[model samples]
Target: MTDALNAPGGLSRRRLLTAAGALGAVGLAAALSGCAADDPLAQQARAGDNKNYVAGDGSVTEYAKDTRKPPVDFTGVLYDGTKLGSKDLVGHVTVLNFWFAACAPCRVEAPELEALHTEFKPQGIVFYGVNLRDEQGTAEAFEQSFKLTYPSFNDKDGQVLLAMSGMVPPGAVPTTLVLDKQGRVASRVLGQLERGTLKTLITSAAAE
Candidate 1:
């Protein structure tokens, strides 16, 4: 993956991170090496949970204002063919969840995500799903099953993921990121979301 990312016309890790306003080179090195022994996602991988996906332990990281990187920028086409970009998110709190239809945790969290989207929409907050592995039909089916109102990006080619490579792990499904009004990542949920916890995270980011 690293090699491919650095290949011609591909995004190198450093360049991607820098472009997305993610942690700097030094910080990226630390983050890559700092996976804790007790991290649920790591433990699940080693244990062969057979869940097919490593579920996050609902861990959350909130970045302080001074420590936040620059605003993130990327362009993507939503399922409905609507184009969305970082500029669309400016001055608004945004939530981006990486998911595919079959991920169990994603299925479990869909309703909650939608509820949060509805609850916060009037407050000028936006939510978007970055569908990593599904085609438009499958993604739409999942959304219909959950009755989700917010639109999702069809990230099949990994363009959105590539843009977000620094902050999101390579194949970590069900990861959620909260971006502040300035478009910088303000917080993140590593696994399945706990509604109250995400709500608090969103509320805090909105407050800022």
Candidate 2:
């Protein structure tokens, strides 16, 4: 897989992290290394690639909830007090990112996430964030510091967080979920992702 990503016109997700390391970054190594096949993050990525965000039996593994819809609807709040819900995002390809302001890993990956959001948003991919285990003011401050342009939901009590199958267990910060236009959980990327990998996901989901 590393070889494949390093091939011509290919972007090895790990290699990208290597370059990111020279810049004195944090958590990029764990984020990228864990993304390899056989790793927990990689398993989720493959499941998503196979359109198995919902398990083989059509059930969410960690969470007991089952969905009749391809993509389940979610509702919460933006950092600025605006409402965010599945209905608000109808007819769009949405990349939902679960994060927390206090998580160092999440903070480290914010720039790259923001970059993907900026690059693909104009192409019809919308980035919706779920800020978990933090106050609205803290989440809002993080957004301001990062100059984040995408809208994010505040999961202060973790009710919304607990409800998300892919996001439950809270194993890691900065989990990503790609929802197709028809509202299916097309891809689930656990932990942070490289810009190239994220772009490819957005492109594929938008095409669907």
Candidate 3:
């Protein structure tokens, strides 16, 4: 989980290969576990596992069907100081990315994330970032530098993180999650995103 994903040169060939392998591993595990949406909320049985993410390994995990957890509820102050809560996203497939101004991988994926925000905007796929560090000006500067339009919450005190409680705790600096229409945790990418995989994940969630 601690592997460096996007370096100064951007996603390396090794990272690409690792992502492919990770996807394969996730698929295999899902298949073996018969994990589907029939009772997605069954995740309650795995509460012990939700303690924290182990590390960043560029892996993607999708909890579709019976394996998806219930919609998470939270409220926080956005970077622009707007009041935001999970209820507002009930009907849409939303993307939540955890990041900060100083993370190299965060900067590397900013443009790509903005692209996803734009591409999915019309489809009702909203993207929001959760700043794990940095104050307003610092986070805003990063957003401006990347020309990102979506609003990010400045969770400097980690209140937003605490709100997550036992479910899908963002364990790494650049974790990305796709919340389904019901606001449930649908899928998560544990490191710097692969645009195609994320797009596919979000698209699938939107369609569902």
Candidate 4:
């Protein structure tokens, strides 16, 4: 396991195992106490409606430079078969969006994400989609339909997701994370991204 998986205050193996088990009222209350009442993950778990995805409230969190955790560590192959790792993201501002083709919020924000990619790529900012579920053909079709220029990772087996489990909620589709030049998470957006908000976040990360 990488540091990202074992970072302080992050999800631990025991917690994950507990989360994977049945959540009765007492268990649900315990989980909710660990996070904010409105936290999408906890809220979704409480709903018990089998929605299969958490619809965040578009919350944005920016970590101060000093408060940021250690640089993230993980590795995965891109949809195009290019291997990438956290080390590769060092010295550049990077954005990672978690999504799947079936996610309605993901579809809604695709153009905005692509637009941001176009605007910032010239400035050396990077963007990648951490696709949670979808076969190659389905993912490819979604990309083609959106005319997305960036490549997504085929994370169906969830290596990328597992590595990022500390930072990202397990089933929060359409979450976006911005990493600073040092590969530490700088900012995060949970839910459908707002173009201006994300643009500002990218700009700030790039400036740092």
Candidate 5:
């Protein structure tokens, strides 16, 4: 993003970490190289192996209707101290974003998520964040700075992450999942978000 885009003091202003690199940049990718240390893609990035892994490339992937598996159901506490679960997400499409307060790419995608939330929320799609790290205060600060209205789960104990287990795995620190109305995992973006791709996915999911 340009300096103008990162400028502060507006309703849409972003008080992002200046030192953190932009999404899809080599520096930003390097920072998350081990964000999920055991994740194969992260390992490849760290080793400079350049294998099948396109680490932090901001790719958006949607599962074919037949390919989508059963819904992911889990429960945890939100930053506001409220309880949330898969049952709570049913009947409406939902977007689950995995992030932490200090992750640069997470900051990069915050506004986009907020925009999607603003657009699709009126259509009844719920947006929630799963924070793999950081305290409540930190997460709330990031929420305020990003002007995000969606509630985020506090996964500090890994309850939410553990529930997602093999699927999405929290391997990529900044991953997003779009759940269909039935609560099934319909689409996933494994790294930094692509705004246009996400909008299309959300739009399609909302229509389903």
Candidate 6:
């Protein structure tokens, strides 16, 4: 999980292919296309055999169905001290990711969360970060350091965590909740997401 995805001057797949095509001229234009067509989450799936994300006592579980709906109104405060409420994200699929900067698994899954944010933003998907047990500076810096575009709500008092304890464990960090347009919990990935699973779940939830 410690690959240098932030490599200096490291060519993104697109950039590398673009440079290749520029040198190749028109001979391989179509060949260079569809580079990211395959699932980006493929790597995580391959690394699945590396770790067991199962929780003790089977307390954490994934939501296997899409029938659950969110409340009509919800509200919270973001890390930047901005107010965010349910009405702001109404009629869109919203993903709430709960994490802390100190958690190693949370760091491992951060990139995938950013990727999902970029991939599904234009598709009517909304992402909200819930920084649990985190300081305002650390949470803000984490978002900035990762280039994460989604706004995060600080759970310094764990108010949101207490509210969601019935559906999610209060001890669970890096928990992801998928909510339908109406603000209902559609699906939840209790632990780290296997790369593309987050994006896929968001897309499916949006379509639902």
- Give the candidate number with the greatest TM-score: 1
> Taking the tens digit of each residue's C-alpha lDDT, what string does model 4 give over 6-72?
4465465325423332332233344233223544533443344326567876666667678888998
> Which residue pairs clash within candidate 6?
41-196, 69-184, 70-183, 70-184
Q: Which ten residues in a row are the worst by lDDT in model 6?
A: 28-37
Candidate 6 has a TM-score of 0.67
Clashes of 4: 0
RMSD of each: 12.2, 11.0, 14.1, 12.1, 12.3, 13.0
- Off-target runs (Cα >4 Å) in candidate 2 are 1-69, 166-168
Error of 6 at 124 (Å): 2.0
**Candidate 3 per-residue lDDT over residues 1-208, each given as its tens digit:** 1212432433553465466556644543342232222222223212223222333666676664566666788898997779999999899999999887666556556666776788889987899999987888988877776678999998878877776665445557678888898888877787666666687678768887
Ranking 5 against 6 by lDDT, winner = 5
For residues 35-137, write the lDDT of model 1, one tens digit per residue.
2233454344435462767567655666767778888879999988899899889989999999988676676566668877998999999999999998899
Candidate 2 local lDDT, 39-112, one digit each (tens)? 44334443454221222211111111133235566678777778767776668888888877655445545666
lDDT of each: 0.74, 0.59, 0.69, 0.74, 0.69, 0.60
Once all C-alphas are superposed, what RMSD does model 2 give against the true structure?
Answer: 11.0
**Candidate 6: tens digits of C-alpha lDDT, residues 35-148:** 212323323322453232333121122343333434635567888789877778768888888877655456556666776678788787888888877788888776775567
Model 6 local distance difference test score = 0.60
**Candidate 5: misplaced stretches above 4 Å?**
1-55
